[model samples]
Target: MKKIILIWFFMMFSMIFSETNSIYNTKIDMKRYPNASVVTLLDRESIIFNKDNSYIIKKHIIKRILNYKGKKASSEYKIKFDKRFEKVDIINAKTVKISKSGIKEIAVDKSKNIRIIDAPSDVGLMKYAAHKMEVIAFPAVNEGDIIDIEYTIKNNKKQKISGTVNFASREAVYNKVEIINIPKDMNFNITKFNWNTKMEYMDNIAKDRKIIKFSEKFMPQILDESNIPESLKFMPTVIFTNYNNWAEYRDELLGKFIKINKSKENLQILKEIKEKVLDKLITKDMTNMKKEEIIQDFIAKHIEIKYIDNLLDFEASSPKEILTRGYGTSLDIENLFLLLLKEEGISGEIVILGSDKLVWDDVKKGIDMNRFNYAISKVTIDNKDYFVDATNEFSKLGESVIENNIGLILDTGKPEFVNVKSIEKNITRIEKSYNIKIDLNGDALINKTIYFYGINAIGEREKYKYMTPIMKQQDYQKELGMISQNAYPISKQMDVELGSPVKISYTYKYTNFASIDGDFIYFDLPYRLDMLDLFENVRKYPFELVSDILRKNNISIEYPANYKVRIAPKSLEIKEKNMLIKRDLKIGNSNGGNKIILDTVVRYNSHIYTIEEYSKLYKILEKLNYPKNAKVLLEKE
Candidate 1:
C-alpha cells in the first residue's frame, strides 16, 4: 500500500509540471518571399515550485518575423533571456515544412515538449534551429520573464522576405526586451552607451516569478577626430556597466582613480596659482594695508568667471576668457578667483565643497568627496584664513555665500585642515512708527510710518518677490492688525528705499476706531491675542519654534476736559529667562475731555525649544492672558 501511494504522488507531480510547461503558441505569417530566411521563438514558461507541494506557473510566447532585403553590413546585437524560476530544459527540435502562406505551426505533447512542425523550407528550418540553440540561456529575471532576441543578416535577396513562427500555447505572457551589445566580429566605434535594467511587477508585492528585467542602450554616432576643434580637448570618457552589485562596482572604480589622479596634480596646480597671485597683489605701496581689504579688492576686481556645462573639460581659453564673459557658474567663478589670486602673488587655494542643499553633515556621517562640486578660494590675510565665494552678485567680501557655507570644504592644494569661521553674530533690525489722532465720532486720522534698517530688510524684500501683491498686502494688514485689530484704515500706500546694507521704510494712513458706551474705547489686537493656549497644546511635540519677537506700543486718546478717569486697569509685568511681557495704562484730564494712553511691550528670544522645555514655557505664558479692568466716568461741564 505504501509503494502504491508513493507512485501516485510521483505521477501527480509529473502531471502538474507537464500541464504548466505546455507552451502558448503564436504565428506571424508573411508569404511575399519564399527563399527569405526567418527565425522564430517557441514559448518560454516560468515554473515556481519549492521543495514542498505549493507551486506557481507563469509563461510567455512570441511568434513574429521581419522580412529583410539582403544587405551586407556588420552589426552588433545581443540576445537576453529571463530565468526567474528553477531549472528547466530548453529543447531544440527539427523544423518541418509548411504551406506557402508563410504560416508555420508548432505542436506540444502532453509532456510539454514543443516541436516546430512547419516552416517554409529546410534552410529556413536550419536557421530556426540555430536560433533556438543559440538563444536558450539563463536570463536574469526576478518578478517576471523576458527574452531579448537579436539577429544579423548576411546574404539573402529573393522575393520580399516574410515568414511566420509559432508558439504552441496561448497561456504565457510574452514581452520583447531590447537588445544592446556590440557583436564580437563588428569593428564599430562606440562613443558612449548606457545600459540599465527596469523591473516590472503586476502588483506592489513582489512574487518569486513576477519581476521582469529589461535593458536599454543609447548610442551616438562617432565624429572624426580631425573635425574636432582644438579648443575642446578635455572630454570625459564614461563607462557604464550592469552587474549584480552596482554600488560596489562604482566605489571600486572611484577608488582606483580618485587616489591616483586627484591628489598630486591637483595640489601642484593650486600651489603654483597661489604664489603667482600673492606676488601680484602685495606691493611696496600696499605694505601697510590690512589683509582683508587687500584680498577683497583683489577678488572683486581680478576674478572673472564664465559658466558653461557642468562637466569639466579642456578649453582653449583661460581666466581672461572668463573675465571677457560676464556670466559663469559657481565653479568657474571660483576657478577664476583662484587664478587671479595666484597672479597677484597671494597664497590662495581652491577648495571643493558641495552645495548646502545636497550635503547633510549628520546624514553623510563623515565628509564625502564625491558630493563636492563648487569651488571656493581660501586666502590667508594677516595670518588668518578666510574663505570667499565671490560668484554671487551682491555677496559681501570675504563672506561665503549661503549655499556654500555649511558643506564640507576640501583644500585641494595643502591638504591641511581649514575651519570656516562662524558669522551668525551679524543681525539686521527694522523699526517703524505711527502717529495719529481720533475725533469725536471714533474716526481716527493717522500717519503710519515703517523703517527697515538692516540686512534682514534686503532678505525680506527678496522674499517678497515670491508673494503676490494681494498676499503682501494681507501680510501688512495682519502685522498692523496685531497692533490694533479694530483700527481699520481707508487707503494704504507703501514706499521702498534702499540704503547701504539694506533699509526700507513705509508710511500710510489709518481711520475708523471703536468706542464703547460713548466714552470707553477698545480695539482688538490680533498680535496681542493670547497664544498661551495654543502653545501649551503643541508643547508636547518633539520640537518647538519660538519666533524672536519684540514689540512696543504707545496710544493716546483725546476727550473733553470735563471728563475724568473713573477706573484704571492694573499694570502688569512678567519676566522669565527668555520671555518678557509688560502693560501700562494711564488716564488724565485733557482740554477736550479725558485723555487715555496705553503702552505694552513683549519680547521673546528663544528660537527653538525641546519638548520638555516647551511644555514648561507654555504653562508660564498661559497665565498672562488674564483680563484687566478699565473704565472712565463723566463730570459736569
Candidate 2:
C-alpha cells in the first residue's frame, strides 16, 4: 500500500508539472550550451501596484545545473535593497535532483544557513545608508540538481524610482517572463535596451487595472569582457518609467541641491574651506587655470570619497555633513566640489551623467534619467566648457573618467543633453627608454627610464604613491616577468609634480637576456606594441579601447667586443585612420662594440571599435607580432 501511494504521488506530481512549457517539467539539454555549466529554465518577475502608492514584486527563478561549476547558481542567494522603501520576503524555495531511479527534493529552512547583513560587501563603500541584504544557501545542492527560488518585495512608500529588468545573465536562459500591473489611468512608458530579438507581449484590461506581459525564449548569456562598460548599460533589459521625463527628474534633483546650497550651515562650511584651503592656492601671478588645478588637487587628495549610506538615508549627503566629516560618498564629494568652486568665483553647475556605453547608438533610444548614476561639475571658462569629477581622485581639473561622457546639464532648470568630451586632448602618453650593455655570455645590464603623461601619469602616481618601496619592487618584478625571467631592479626614482607628467626611472639587470647558438647570438625585441592583442580572443560584442593612447619605446643596445650583427628584422611602419605603429632599427659603432638602437611607437586614436574593425586590427597585429621577424641576430667578426 505504501509503495502504491508513493508511486501515485509522483505520478500526480509529474502530471501537474508536465504542462506545456512549464519550468518544472523542462529538461535542459547539456549539449545546447557546451561552455555553460548551468542554464536558467525560467525567470519570471511580476509587479502589482496598489492604489496607495505601494507595490509588490514576485520573483521566481528556476535553474538547472549541469556540472559542479553549475552549483554556484544554487550555492547562495542574495537580495539587496534600501530598507526604507522595500522589504523582502522569501515565499518558498526548494531543490530537486533527478536520477534514473527516482527523484529527491530538499526544501529551504530559514532556521539554518541564512543571514542578514547590514553593511555592503564592497570595501570601498563609505556611505552610511540603511541598506540591507538577505543571504541564504540552498541545502543538498549538487551537480545535475535543479533549484527553484521564489521571493517577493513589498514597497513601503511611494515609488520615486523607475524599474529596469534584465533578461540576460552569465548563464543562458530558456524562457523569461515579466509582467507589470498599474492603474488604468496612469501614464507610463517602457524603453528597451540592447535588444536584439523581439519578445511576445500582451496588454489586457482586467476590471480597473491594466496588465502587461512580456515573454522571451532562448536568450543566450552575455559574455563578460574586460574594459567594456557594465552590463547595465548594454544588456538586454526592459526599462519602465512612471516619473514622466528627464526634465521633471532633473528639476527635483537640482531643487534639492539648491535648497541645500542656500542653507547657512552649508554656506559657512564653504567659506571655511575657501579660507583654509583655497586662499593659499590663489597667487597673484597664477592664472585661473592654475588656481583651479590647485583647488581640485587639494580636495581630491584630502577629502576621501566613499560609498557610504544607510537604510534610512537614501538621499544624497548634505554639503555641511560632507565638509565637516572630511569624507563622504562619491555624490557627496562631487556636490561639495561644486560648492567649493562657487566660492572661488567660478560659475558652474552640477551635471547629471551617464556611461559612454549607454550612448552607443544614440542617446534617445536608451535615454532614461535613471541611467544617469553619476554627477560632475561643469564650468565654462572664456566661452569654453570643462567638466571634472572630484570623486575620482586621479581626475584632473578639466578631465573626468571616460565612462561619464554622456551628460545632461541641469543648470538652466531645463536639462539639456550634452556630449561631454575630454578637454585634455593628449590624454595618455608613455615614453620608455632603455640603455642595455651586453656581455659575450649574453647577459645584460639595462638602465631604463619611463615617463607617463596625462591619464597614464595619474594612474602610475596613484598606484605607487602609497605603496612601500619593497612592495613596489615586488609589483614591478611581477610586471616585468613578461620581458625577462631574471629581471631585478637595482635603483628606482619617481618624479611627480603638479601640472607635469609623472616620470619613473629605474635600472635593472637581466641574466641571459640573449640566446647564443655557437658563434651566433640572438636578442629579443624589448617593446610590446599592440595592447588589444593581449586578450587574444575575438569578443562577440564590441570591445572598448577606452581612450587615445600613445606608447613610445627606445632601446639602445651595446653588444660585446668583436661582435657584429649578422641579421635583423626589417624596419616596419603601419598607419591607419585610427591607429599608427612604427618600428625603426639603426645600427652604429659605440665603445669598440656593435651598437643597436631600436625605437617603436604605437598610437590609438579612437575609444571604440566594431568587431570588424577589431578583426582588421588583429590582422595588423599578426604582422607586427611575428616572432621570427622580431629577432635581432648577432655574429662574431
Candidate 3:
C-alpha cells in the first residue's frame, strides 16, 4: 500500500524520466560526451508546499560512470539539513555494474556505510543551528557503473519556501527536471540568475495550488577552472523569494532582530555592561574616532565569533547571552557592537553583504536574500559612514573583510542600497629589497628584507598564527632556498607590530649562485611576478583578481669589476587603465667598483576585469613577464 502511494505521489509531479526500468539499464551514447567524467541519466526535484506553509523536497538522481575519475566522483556524497527545522530521509540508494553482455548488482550494507554527523560540515549552511550531514558511500562503485540516490527533506515547521535551483551539475546532465507545487496564497517570486539558456517554462494554475515545471534536455558540465570567484552563482540558477520589496524585507528582518535583542532582563544587563565598558575604555574628552576604535577593538577582542553563511538562521542565542558567555555567532557579535554604539549616542545598523555585483544583478526587481550570506555593522559618526566588522580581530575600524565592498544597509528610517569603495588600502602593499655580493667562485651572500602592510600583513599573520617559533624559523630558512639549491640561511628576524608593517629580514649564503666558466657567467635574479595564464583565452565567466596590489622590487648586486655585463641594459615601462609596470635596470658604482641595480614597481589599479577588458589587460600583463629582464650574462673585460 505504501509503495502504491509513493508511486502515485511520484506520478502526481509529472516528471518525465524517459522510462528507465532500472538505473543500470539505461544505455547512453558515450561518444556524445567525450571529455565528461560521468553522465547523469536523470535528475529530478519536486518541491511540494503544504497548506500549513511547510514544504517537502523530493530529489532523485542517477549517474553512469565512464572511467576511473567518474567512479571516484560518484563513490561518495552527502546530504545536509538543519535538524531543528527540517528532517531528511534517504528513501533508497544502490550501485550496479552494467555491461553489454550482463548486469551485476553490488550488495553494500547501507547501515554500515552510512554515517550521520551533527556537526556543521558545510560553510554554506547555518553555523550555530542544529545543522547535520548524512554521508553515504558506494564502496562498490566502479568504472562503467550506475549509482542511484533518492531522498526527501521535509520541514518540521511551516515556513516560507526559499532556496536556489541550479540547472547544471559537475558532469554532463542528460535530463533535468524541476517541479514546484506552491500554495496559491503563498505567492513566492522567482528570480533567475546567469540564465543564458532559452527554455520554455510551464505554469499551471489550479483550484488551491499553482504548479510551475521546467525540464532541460542537455546540460554540459560546468568546468572547475582557476581564478573563478563565487563559482556556484555563475551557473544557470533560479532563486525564489517571498519578499519583493526591499523596504518591507528590511523591516521584517529588523523587527526580528529587535525582538531577539529586546528582553528586559537582557537589556538591563547590557546597560550595566555598557556603563562598565564606557568607564574603562572611554573618557569624556576623547575624540569620536578614538572612541570608535576603542569600542570596536573591545568587541573584536572580547567576543569569540563563529562565522555564518549568506542567509540568517535567526536561531542563535541573544546578544546578552553571548556577552556573558564570551562567545557568540557573527550576528550576536554584530548586534552587541550596534548596541554599544547606540549607548554612546552613535547610530549604527546591520547590513547584509553580497560577494560581488554579479550576485545582486536583480536588485532592481527583487533582492534574493540568499545571495547575501554575511552581515556587518555600519556606523555613522560626524556625518561620515564606517563599516565595522566585529568578527575579525585583524581589521580596524571602518575596515571590512569584504573583498568587493558591496551590501545593503538595513536602515529602518530610510532603507537603501549601499556600494562603498573600500577595496584598496594604502597599507596593503609589498616591498622587497635585496643586496647581493658575489665572490670569484660565483658564490653570493644575499641580504633581503621584506615589508608587508595592510591585507598583506593580515595574510602573514594568519600564515604564522598556528606556527611555532621553530616552525617559523625552519619555514623562513626553506624560503630563502628558492634562490639557489645550496642556499644556507645565516641570520633571520621577523617583527610584527600593531598598526605597522610586518618586517622580515634574512641573510643567506647562496652557493653557485651563477654559472662561471672563468670568462662568462649567467644567472637569473631573484624576483616575484604573478603569471597571467588563467585568462589566456576568452571566457564566458570573469577571471577574478580579488584585490588591488602594489609590488616593489629593488635588487643590488656587487660583482667582480673585471667582468662586464654582456647584455645591454634597458628600462621598460607600461601603463594601462587597470595596471602599471615599470622596470629599470642600469649599472651603477659602489665605492668606484661596479654594481648592478634593478628597481621594478608593479601596481594594479583595479581588482576585476571583464572578458573584453581581460583581453586588453592580457596584453598589458604579458609585457610584465620578468623572465627576459631577470636573465643576465656577464663576460670578462
Candidate 4:
C-alpha cells in the first residue's frame, strides 16, 4: 500500500507540468540558427524524488524539423532502462502541426510500432546495465513538422541516484530546462560541467518540497570539430548525485567487491594456478617480480576481455564463473586478478578509473561511476608500485595502455585514490637500427633491427598476432619502400612476447637510393625527419594525445672508399614546451670505407597541448623540415 502511494506521489509532481507554457508555443526565427537542421521548441526534464528513495525522471522535448536530415534524425528515438533497476514508460510521443484554426497532434501508438530490444549502454569503460530499450518511431515525420516526445524512467534503485543531463543538442535549441524536486531537507550535489549558466532554486515551493530549475535559451548545436579533448568540455551538462561524499561511494563498492572474493569454487581454481605457477618447490626461491610477471602474463595470454565499454553496466561475477565463461568484462577480469593475488599471498588491489582523460579534480565534482573506462591491477614489488592491465593481449607488465592521472584503488574496506603518474611517464619507445651498404651504383642492401618497448611492443605484437608470415613480409616490404621506390623486404624475423620487449629484424634492398650526377652523388637520409606534421593544423580545440612517443632512428651508410664527402646533412635540435626533436651525426671510417652515421630522436612529452603551444611547435617544425638539411653530397676522389 505504501509503495503505491509513493509511485502516485512521484508521478504527480513529475508529469503534471502544463504544455501550454509560452516556451512551448514560442516561434523561433529560423534565420538565427542557419546551421541547424532542426529547432528545439522545448526540451525539458523533470526529476521527482520520493520519500521512499524512488525517482521519476520525466523528459519532454519538442523539435521542429527544418530539413530531411532533421526528419530522419529525430524520427526514431530510444529510451533504455534496466529491469533490475528501473522501468520505462513513454508517456507521450506525437507530431504537432500548427494550423489556421487549431493545433493538430498525431500520436504514435506505443504498443504497436515500438521496437523493444535487449541492448546495453557502452559506458566508455565497459558495457553497463541499462539493458532493455524502447525505440519509438514517429509516423509520417515531415519537414516543418514538430516532434514532441515525453517519457519517464521510474527508478527504484534509489541508492544510485546519479546521472548527467546535457543541455546541448544535435540541433539548435531555443529553450532547455531541467527541474529537480526533492524533500525540503534533502541536499543533493549539483555540479555544472561546461555549463556557464545558473539555476534558480525555490527552497519553499511547497510545505515540504524544494524545487531547482535550470533554464537556458538559444543553445547552439553541437558540431563535429577536430582536436577536442572531450565533447563534455564543450557541451553544457549537469551531473547530480546524492552520495554525500566519496567515502560513502567507496563503502558501497567495497561491500560488493568483498562479496566477490568469498566463493570457494573460485578459490580452488586460484590455488591450482598458484601451485602450477609456483610449483610448491621450496628450491625455486620464488621472487616477488617473478610471481607478478607469471600471474599477469598467464591471465593476459589465457583470459580474453570482452570489449564491451564502461563501469556501471557490468556485474562482477564470481571467480569460477569468470573462468568458466572464458571471457569476462574488464572489471570482472581485473577482479579476478585481485582474487588471484590474495591466493598467491601477494598484496595487491584492483584499481578503477574513468578515462585517463579526467583526473580526480574534474571527477571529484560528483561521484559518478559512468565516467570510468578502465580497471587495472596494482602491486608493490621491490618497493616499487606496478600497475598491470591484462586487457591488452600484448601489453607488458607495468605498461598501461591508457593515459590517466588518477586511479581509485579498491582496498579492503578502504578505497583510496592513487596518482597514475608513473604509467603516464611510461614511454612507448621505438628504436630503429639501420645498416646500409651502397655500391658505386647508389643501390644499397639495408639490414634493420627495430626494438619496441612498453606500449609500442604491444602495438607491434597486436598488429601481427593474427597475420601469416607472408603477410608480415608484405607489410615489411611496404614499410621499407618508404625509403626508395623499388625497396622490398628480403627476410624478416620477429620474437613476440607480451610482457617483454618485441624485436623485429629484417633485410631489405633500396634501389637508386642516391641520385647520381656525372661525378657527384647526392643522397638524402632515408629517415622521416618530419614528425610535427601530425599536429600541423592546430585546430580550434586543444590537441589531445593518448600517450607519449619516443622514436630513435640510427642510420649508417657505407660508400666506396674512393668517394670523399662534399656535403654532410646538418644536425638539428628543435625543442618546445612539451616536445623534443634532435638529431646528431658521427662521421668516421668503417670497413675501409667512408661511413656517415646519423642518429635522430623525437619525443612528445605531454598528453594535451593548447593551440598556442602547437603553434610554437609548428614554427619549430618549419625550420627543421625545410631547407634540405638532410642532403649529403659525395664526390669521387
Task: Go through the candidates in order and give the clash count of each.
Answer: 45, 14, 3, 11
Between candidates 1 and 4, the TM-score winner: 4
lDDT of 4 by residue, 1-637 (tens): 9999999998876665444434446777867777888888887888999876689989988888888988888888888777677888888898777657767788998677688877645333233434677888988788887888888999886665577777766578888888889887786888776766353333346788878887788875665554456545656677787767766755555676566576676667777766765455312467766766666766776677776544544556776776665767777888877666666566777777664543346566666656555677787766777777855656655676654557777665555787653354346778889898888888888888878777677687788888887887667666766656787666654333433567777787778888789889988776765453354454555566555678899999898888888998767787776788889988889879989999999998646666677667666766666647778899988
Residue lDDT tens for model 1, 1-637? 9999999999999995464333212342233223322222333333232323123333333322232321111011112221222222333221222345542333223143332222222123221122211122222211112122212222111111111111111112133222222223322121221222332222112433223223211111122222121111122121112222223322332243244334665456545545666556566566422433455455555644433222121122234444445434455555556544544455655555542332233213322233344556676655656666655333343334432233343333223333343233322223344444545454555555444332344455455545776886787677667656655545463434433234333333344453545555453221242352243344323332222444555556554454455554557887877667787877765554566666767665523344566666666655544343333343323
lDDT of each: 0.39, 0.72, 0.72, 0.71
Error of 1 at 6 (Å): 23
**TM-score of model 4 vs. true structure:** 0.85
Please provide, for model 2 over 98-198, each residue's C-alpha lDDT reduced to its tens digit, 9 standing for 90 to 100.
77766677998888867888746544554554668898788888887888888999987775457667766677889899998989887767777666647
- How well does candidate 4 match the true structure, expressed as C-alpha RMSD? 5.3
lDDT of 3 by residue, 1-637 (tens): 9999999988965543425444447667767666788889888899998877688899998888888988877787688887777888888777867766776666546689888886554443333646788888976787878887888999866644356677766678888889889888876787766666465478898998899887777775666656765544556767676654566656655665666667887688678877877768788888777777788878877877766552445554676777777876666678778887777788887877764654444444545565655678887888877777866766655445555556778666766777643435533478999999888898989888888766676667567766888888778766865555688877754443445466777788899998898799878788746544454655766677755668899999998888888873368887788778888998977886678999988877545567787777765566555477567888998
How far in Å is the alpha carbon of 589 misplaced in model 1? 11
Q: Which has the greatest TM-score?
A: 4
C-alpha RMSD of each candidate structure in angstroms? 21.1, 5.4, 4.7, 5.3
Task: List the pairs of residues colliding in candidate 3.
Answer: 309-373, 310-372, 310-373
Best of the two (2, 4) by lDDT: 2
**Candidate 2 lDDT:** 0.72
How does candidate 4 score on lDDT? 0.71
Candidate 1 residues lying further than 4 Å off, grouped into runs, are 1-326, 335-365, 368-391, 394-430, 451-455, 461-493, 524-541, 544-608, 616-637
lDDT of 1 at 446: 54
Model 3's alpha-carbon lDDT is: 0.72
Clashes of 2: 14
